[model samples]
Target: MKASDQTLPLQNGETLDILFRSHPRARRLKLRYDSVRRAAVVTLPPGVSEKSGLDFARRNSDWLQEQQKAFAGQEFLSPDNFISFLGHDHLILHQPDDAGRVRREDGRIIVGGPAGGFEVRLLNWLKKQARIRLEQAVEEKTGLLGVTCHKIRIGDPGSRWGSCSSRKTLSFSWRLIMTPATVFDYVVAHEVAHLREMNHSPAFWREVDRLVDHATISRRWLRQHGPQLMALQICGKSPAD
Candidate 1:
């Protein structure tokens, strides 16, 4: 299920939903935040009932609330906060005196600019990276499929990541840049495949598989984490702020 589908109410009327699933090897009920997926997860042991797991969740509401708060505005790019780049977290460092352009070094995004406009600089840098990679992937995948993509446009759309127009123009979310290259490639391949077959028919899927191996893995990754990327505010002020 998508992250937006279900929500659990926490303190301050916040709803950062927790994911509950059963695990055969679990020895007991377990509740912890999945940093990679950015959600609270509860695991029920073989004999533990779902009711017990939920009660365990509610019993620890205080900790859960803290997690929710930490994750809420954590996506805002600022000094001392890490931002996603190439599917990895890069610490944001503002070197105001340097007066250099944005660059990467030692698992950090080094920004040499005034602190107030620091995030805006990083935002533009990330978008440029998105365009370069998306275009390259589209060109390669379309060539393999023996099709043509008229144009490629990159932007940040809240829900949809990528789309194919009837005119053969392809649009993709700049947020895809935050994910691993494999995930980015999967989205491009999916859209380029649409150039050959508009509908998501079996033939269309077959075309996608031909362009990208292990398509299922990439699809699952997106469904699990895409919403988080959508919720992540790159530039604008957070709703809570």
Candidate 2:
């Protein structure tokens, strides 16, 4: 049965979730086995019956088994895992000594100057600096584009370096702080372009080009180097961890 046709209590080992959209269309049944959570979620249309969803999962049992196998041997680090930032590889020093400097050496953030709590202190300072630089880039380019943005926020995002929401808010990944100045400008320009053109249309590209001529180069840099920034293995994991 289609996921949209049932409404009943879920059985053991099954969790229910429904994603509703204003643009109603064909109902889909997604049985995702989350290895990290160690459970299976049967996502169906709202007001759907649990018996049919369970049956659907049973029918796809082989596929789910394959997925679990794929998740095997995946490495998940704890908060204390060592990470390499910029180009420097270092341990996550939680015990602050208060005798270190936040330096940009080669490509890593060096936090061991005179400070004892180097990791926490360095992360805090870097986040602040990143916010400042991102806000400046956004302001400078948004003016050029003649578009007013809602608000600028900085956080660690797993997937994208930056995102433009329908609410007109622009959020940037904190990892951008590790990249060169050019990549930072490109991301800001890209998000600002969304203000004028909400969608990724030709007009949006035109606006981005006007602000940053080498937008494509910066984009390529993200696709290549962005993942490395995320690899800089400091502890304190995000939700995805």
Clashing pairs in 1: none
How big is the positional error of residue 214 in model 1, measured in Å on the Cα after superposition? 1.7
The C-alpha RMSD in Å for every predicted model, in order, reads 10.0, 8.0
| CA lDDT, candidate 1, residue 199 | 74
Q: Candidate 1, residues 70-173: lDDT per residue as tens digits? A: 54544666677777787898888889986858888899988886777776777777788889998888888888989998888887644568999889999988
**CA lDDT scores, all candidates in order:** 0.76, 0.61
Cα lDDT for residue 241, candidate 2: 16
Q: How would you encode candidate 2's per-residue C-alpha lDDT over 27-64 as one tens digit per residue?
A: 56556554334345566565665665677776766555
TM-score of each: 0.68, 0.58
> Distance (Å) between predicted and true CA of 42, model 1?
29
The Cα error of candidate 2 at residue 215, in Å, is 1.1
